[model samples]
Target chain A: MDIFRRNNVTVAGNPQGPTVVLAHGFGCDQNMWRLTVPALADAYRLVLFDYVGCGRSDLTAFSEERYASLEGYARDVVEVCEALDLRDATFVGHSVSSMVGVLAAETAPERIGSLVMVAPSPRYVDDEGYHGGFSAQDIDELLASLDSNYLGWSAAMAPVIMGHPDRPELGEELKNSFCATDPDMARVFARTTFLSDTRDDLGRVKVPTLVLECVQDVIAPREVGAFVHQAIPGSSLVTLDTTGHCPHLSAPEATNEAIRDFLAGLPR
Target chain B: MIHTDQQPEPYESQNEGAPDIQSHRDSTPDAAFAALLEDSAEELYEAAPCGYLSTLMDGTIAKINATLLDWLGLERDAVLGRMRFADLLTVGGKLYHETHFAPLLRMQGDISGIAMELRCANGDRMPVLVSSVVKYGESGEPLLIRTTLFDARDRRAYEEELLRGRKAAEEARRQAEADRARLQDALTVLQKSLLPDTLPTIPGVETAAHYHIASPDRLGGDFYDVFPLDGERFAFFLGDVCGKGPQAAAVTSLTRYTLRAAALHDADPASALATLNTVLHDRYTGSGDPRYCTAIFGILTPGASPGRLTIQLASGGHPPAVVLRADGTAAFLPTPGGLLVGVLPDAHFATAETVLTPGDTLLLYTDGLTEARTGADRTSLYGDEALLAFAADHAGKSTVDVIGALTDLLASFGDGLDDDTALLALGVPPLTAQP
Candidate 1:
């Protein structure tokens, strides 16, 4: 149960400087941070890792009962910190992983110095007083779409070039550079991410936090980000002019700059 | 090439700087045939079976085939420069396209067979299968995305049929699971009916019992009961039927009632077991899947003095009972030469007589306690010797204490306890019974 091997932990950049952990969302791995990592590479230590049952992390370590809720995912984050002996680290989480960071910070408050949530939604299903932009039936349809399309995704996205059998290292490079995930793991992760409700966990944050809301995101709307900001005390909120849920991929420069500005303003 | 005066000009080839090998270079038949082939290239592109289109890296449609434009019911000029490929998709499909498909295509260089529905110009929706590849330049930069679209009308109909079949199968499976759960609940209730809801409280004797079911899905044959026979005597029996399910449950009920009837008739443990053996042998002879049982029947009566009790216990091919004394001593009350009941016409049963003094406990359990598999190998059993040692270690314990410790021992076995266990313990208190 080595956490580094369990989560495919990768450490880069200035090791002596402040640590920034980048966590990917439901459908992707740590490679999603490729565009944003370089923006902070000169000033901070970059820590990247995939959750269990995603990317190159050990598939044998997955247990359905253990991952039925986001708390189990938070346990993984805490275990990673414990394994690396990281303290006062900044956590950058995208989509569902943002709530995962909130839960992790609640668990070990002294270990995390701050949090940055990008395009986050505390609840995806619509409730009585809140509009999360998705219905239960919509979520069910999304799960069905995943079921019908998983095989196609697996065969087409195996990270191996179609005509390059002679150079195996090229395939290895593609595997490391892209989001290569097992189909079954991806389905379970989608269920765990979209079906989770952790809005109550947001109010427990005592550290300095930043909420980055994309102006036109389909997955997490602007109001949801504003709700997160209002729930967590003394948290700063910034609205990005990006048009997609993935600002890191679609608008990396703006996303990175917003993060940099937020980090620079924090009292280290 | 025979290019007649009626044909329009050949459409321009999109590839730049290509050799004009298909043109009429010479007047030979080979050259003329090549020119003829070149003349129909635009015709093929316009009326091809599949729809083809090219888009810029930012998803703007740079070119499109005539077949795709015909399907959308739109003019050529309206779509050529006005729409992104994602704009053609439905709202949900567009979301999925942006979130998963676009990112994958950008990173992986190719993606295929993505299911999506396209919103046509006339406000009608059409289901389509799309496959796209990124064309790279000499410098390894992405130039354009070439996508081929297949009309999925027949395919969608077939998929709807398949979806209906799959949903039916899923409903049937869910129904079967719910049926299995309800049957398990009924069996559990029937099994519980055979045991006393609460052990009858004897003024001088303290009694406790525990039943360990290996699985809730199947009924276990283990049964135990403590019921009074008369003013001064109580009858108790603990046994295990050979198999599980309703048949074993029936046997368990028969054996329990038969033991009570025989004990009430003769008020002797040995004669009661003999009657049960005769009844079971008579009922199961010449039957399909013959059933049998191992039992230990006992009669309890208060002695002449307080804090004293005498018991006569009989075993029919069952494990011997254990006695943990008040002075920290433990031993098994051996009942030897007992044959399995309902197996033979003249099966023998043996009786053991023991006294329960102050602070002494007597334990009766089925073979599940001794024959439980131990450790990871699953072949080594927690044998009778281990049970004897366990009894010795927990000596001078009350009835509840003994039962609780045995329950913990059963739990420690985890998945190794493959059979159900029945435990009954009776003790005489050192002090006043309720003080």
Candidate 2:
């Protein structure tokens, strides 16, 4: 199987420059970084791809036995790096993909130079001594919300609340687009994303890492970002004033600048 | 103009000289109508069935109806500019609002029928169903979120009852699964009891046996045993009962006990099978359910000459026993024209006599081996020809070697082996063993 075709890998920017891979979170595809890509495209070679079962990736390649955990997704990340012939790459991951980057960097440390985790939560469900910000019942409600509002919610509300007042077409394009995957696959992906616990894998990260916490993010709260930063050795934490789960989409300027500063400060 | 027309009494009071008609009374229609309109609008806003509110995009409360304030037990002044909608909910509800509700509203524009619990001024929780829509400005930018909430006391109570019922059902399902596993365990123990714990060793013969269970959940009806009948002689039997489960197990136990007793009594394989056939036919003849089996009974005796063993075998509708010679050749020991045992009052069983020389083996197996599917498509069976070829390929091997090859073959079948099978191989030691 062709790894690029399996993951729908797309390459842009400086061909000879060091690679910067942008991995999107759950409920979204590669297009989620549409707002932040242009900022880093000039100086860095960008590699963007959708996880299998998202975007234009081959859906037939999905196997239950192969993708039983986030490690399977990390394997896809490693394969994407190998397919693109990239080295010492910077991995920028959002939401669930943040933990995915951690796993991928651990898998092939030589391939990844640094990691930028935006609004990352290593776990979502609450534990004995930790507050992952959600109870089991809350996750159930979220799944039910997905069930009730699959495509209908997008058509009904896309124009009003999506931040792009100047370009409503962006919202319209997202209606049954972007994260428009098979509903069954989406449900499985959601389960795999939220039910995962990867806090133990953070210590294995050898690459320099950045933890970006948004001011009012409901998904990954301040404490979660702090916990991630404390877990990864020598990782820097940047708290953005952005007020939503999606910092790149809601506040692309601050998100891109923070990433830029971190990449520049790296010992290249 | 209507007020001026209806102001006859006031006009009369002003002009006291005018006529005072009986129907001409004083009236203040303008003031009364103005007061009524003002009272109704305020009343409707204060006491509507559903609560209504509008909040800024960041969730700070701007305007709220009196009905909502009353439900929360909070004064209008205290809630107006102070708290966001998410702040009013319980912790779990707050998390849900932030993760699912807020993101969904931002991307889609409206959310409805969401279940949440709002905190009251008294620190009590109130269950409510909420629906909200994002209002847009002329430029399509979000202006404010208009929301409607309904008191869901009855719905909550009903759902709680439903939840209790669902929990009970789930408990019942788990209990049923546990009970089923216990039954399967019991069945496995019962099935093991019918087979030999260990094959009894003869002075110069080696033996090995294997049983393949298609499923552990159900009891298989195959049985094999080797035991001493009398001095210098031993009896052995392997058979497949007609069906599975408790009834077939009963017949298998009865057949095994009867064969051992009959062989010990007469020292002949043919007589032993005859006794089993008679007992089974009599037991199930008048009963609605009839049990039957295909079986082979054998009696082995050390040869009066050296480097050999004498065997007398009887078959009742069973596959012919196979023999592998020391000279690297294999052939079937023919026991033809036999009928299935326990099916008839006088069913005839055939007897065959053979000798096992040094390094020769005699193998007996059930139909499951030959009938197992042999291909990925499951269209081809590991038929009698394949079994014969397998025996020929390992003709000069010992009992353990033959059983090992058969074990590999069975595993290679994988899910294709859909039936329970039993294999028994008895071999004489090589001639040079006693040197």
DockQ of each: 0.16, 0.12
* C-alpha positional error of residue B109 in candidate 1 after TM-score superposition, expressed in Å: 2.5
**Prediction 1 global C-alpha lDDT:** 0.81
TM-score of chain B of each: 0.78, 0.74
Candidate 2 residue-wise lDDT at B282: 96
**Colliding pairs, model 2:** A157-B108
**Number of colliding residue pairs in each model:** 0, 1
Predicted model with the maximum TM-score? 1
For model 1, how does the per-residue alpha-carbon lDDT over B1-435 read when each residue is reduced to its tens digit? 011122221255533212464344454467667765564566677888888888877677888889999888878888887887877776656656755777677666777777777778888878788888887765666667778889987887777677678668879999999999899889878879888899999988989999998888777899888889899999999999999878888999999899888988997887888899899988998886677899999999899998889999899998999998877778999999888888888888989999998889999999888999997889899998889889988877778988999999999998889899999999997663458
At residue A47, give the lDDT of candidate 1. 92
The 0-to-1 C-alpha lDDT of every candidate, in the order given, reads 0.81, 0.81
lDDT string for model 2 (A1-268, tens) is 8888788788988777678999988876787787678898888899999998776677778876566689988999999998876789999999999999999998898899899999999999999988898888777755654543343333333333223457655544443355455555666777788899999998888889999999887679899999999999999999998676888865678999999999898887
Considering only chain B, report the TM-score of model 2.
0.74
User: What lDDT is reached at residue A132 by model 2?
Assistant: 90
